[model samples]
Target: MPPGITTLAADAPTLSAANTGFMLICSALVMLMTPALAFFYGGMVRVKSTLNMLMMSFISLGIVTILWVLYGFSLTFGTDAGSVIGWSQDFLGLSGIGVNELWDGTTIPVYVFAVFQLMFAVLTPALISGALADRVKFTSWALFITLWVTVVYFPVAHWVWGSGGWLAELGVIDFAGGTAVHINAGAAALGVIVVIGKRVGFKKDPMRPHSLPLVMLGAALLWFGWFGFNAGSWLGNDDGVGAVMFVNTQVATAAAMLAWLGYEKLRHGSFTTLGAASGAVAGLVAITPAGGAVSPLGAIAVGAVAGVVCAMAVGLKYKLGYDDSLDVVGVHLVGGVIGSLLVGFFATGGVQSDAKGLFYGGGLDQLGKQAVGVFAVLAYSLVVSAVLALLVDRTLGMRVDEDDEISGIDQVEHAETAYDFSGAGGGAAPRATASAPGTPAAPTNKKVDA
Candidate 1:
């Protein structure tokens, strides 16, 4: 155990087999979300940039995992230095932690808890990649994730979740990470997009996804992994709060999917698969911060509102002239705000009786607190992320050149492609003759037996 840390007394049951197992499983589930997100964002961009899109998320797992174990955990969860940030060096590399030492309020090992939160650290910045897709330099993005996580994500996480952090002391109610994760990443995306500028053809090109099936598959994985993301946040199975959160997550996602489809039919005259997947994600984001506090009915309200509002919000990029290629700003920023704020109004004294919402007779007090947390994170993340992106842009460069953007970021940055259409997958598509890079393919007119 660390010098000042406390744990369950040795006389009492020190470890619960069930809770440890549950947390381990939950950690694994959250780990899968990064790759799941890679697929989710991967299938949304044009095929030329798909591999690069996947890499943007995949690289976070490598970068942030190292940083987290080194000092990230210490800065976010260590003893408070000034009520704004945790001890920056105490838990470096998680040193001085014992395998049997238990985390407070639970029987699980501290290692289990540390790794679980590490997964959140990994996924948060990857969430921003979708907005800047098709245009960023992979090296610059990697560097930005390093600096941003250190400066922005780590300190904000401390403020929201650490014991003496101001937000935790101020009655903020982020059961999960409406403030730290979603809102942080979403607002950061907007900041970077301002500097990254538009893709080659902001609204002029028909940049339809190359594969809807891939998008659907990725969404399915995200839905599966989110159970652990939202529910396992409780850190123990003994509390019934996890169960309520689980059910709320499901219902809210289902409601959001339907709401999005309905909005599409009313506005565009057709229901689309993309709408269904995006709506489900919108619902997932909406319930993440509120699920532990709201009743099932409240969840339905939140999901429906997010589905409709986010469906409308995605169009803002076009009208406002900022290009968010994958709608991260709309889905995450808008959905996160909806979830965080609605908790102020929909909280039903579910988790804590004193945390009732306005309709529950708690009045507008909680609503105002929620607004403070939401906008505080929004403003801080937006400003810091923009400064980081701009600094990286000036020093190391940020966006790829126009030619690379047009041809394909996959080959330009990563030296690979997502698909090889030259009959590589047991198909009979003709292989092009070696010639100039942009030459048209020769057609075959030879007769062949059926």
Candidate 2:
């Protein structure tokens, strides 16, 4: 080695190793969102299905995690031909993905990117399960998720985020899967709700959540993990990663929280904790797409509007009779659209790398592009998700038998209860069945702290 040559940078091995470590950590952070999601969905349901609801997120951790490593990543991020889907050039195995490989000139192991993106792929569909809770068969759900991921999720992920996809080619700027994750999942939830129909006692019964604090706990965890989810989209420790994502996340979330609470007080005459938690999530969803492309103030504007709009949207389901159990359509889908479109008008200097927003004197070209991108994604997701739901219904069947649904799926499906206070009762009090034709019993007063 010549003295002036500086050892030629160790053949890219050192840099690749460092970036791989950072990505691996980011993957772990994203994985935390599943359990966080468990609490979020779990707390929204009645007590009978608390454990069952939480298990939905947990099952994705088991199922999607393994599947992604096998062929999911290949189908998604593999080399593309014409941007429809990736070729099987790396199929059935992660062949040719080595430490020296580079994605966009960064010296990171391609496998690291594969795994981190896999975490996102795993959690996206799980977010929709909340909308069809307490009714559908678990077996049918597992089948639906499997097919949905393969057909709807993988192809759309490729179109939006993978290399050379049409959306990417069209200059659509989705910093962290606003269309791929949220809009796709939200739309899918609507499709499933249509197929499965409503819960037995949906509108007539109170159906209030058994635990509010649990919901708040889940929201907090999601808030914590989202920092990694949004910022980590940079795919490396880049110059703007910290500044752009950090302030965008905080400011938007804060504004949404305030907006939601304010609207609730005005409309409902009371500010419920549930509203606060939901508002925070609404803000988070709105900020996701624009996090890396909008100024801090722009993020706040986007989030505030999202919080108000989504809060109102929650009522639309009731008025329309769709039975979106957990408001996935209201929050994620609506919020996603708001964020994806607003960024085109709010993007500023250095955020978009050769693009500016309407406020910054960039004109309506960017906003038009953003609208085109949003509509394309929304239409594609709706058609694909509808097909997936129908397939699940026709083949294995999508919903449970009436008796099973009436009996509460926790015992019939998973063979477990979310709570067992009978042991403490000294065999004195009789255990209540979940579907006793009355309101489901709340769990024992013993509460888990948020």
Backbone collisions counted per model: 0, 0
lDDT (10s digit) by residue, model 1, range 347-366? 99857346989988889988
Model 2: residues >4 Å from true position, as ranges?
1-18, 425-450
What is the number of residue pairs that collide in model 2?
A: 0
- Cα lDDT listed for each candidate: 0.92, 0.83
Per-residue CA lDDT of model 2 for 1-450, tens digit only, reads 446765345454345565567677778888888899889989999887787788877888778877777788888887887897876655446675655666655656677777788889888988998998888767778878888888888888898888888888887878888899999889888877877789887789877888999999999998888887888788777576545886798889989989999999999899999999999999999998888888888988998999999999999988999999899999999999999998788888577466787888889877887888788878877777777778878988877777877777788778898888877857555565666567667667656699
Ten residues in sequence with the least summed lDDT for candidate 2: 6-15
What TM-score would every model get versus the actual structure?
0.92, 0.90
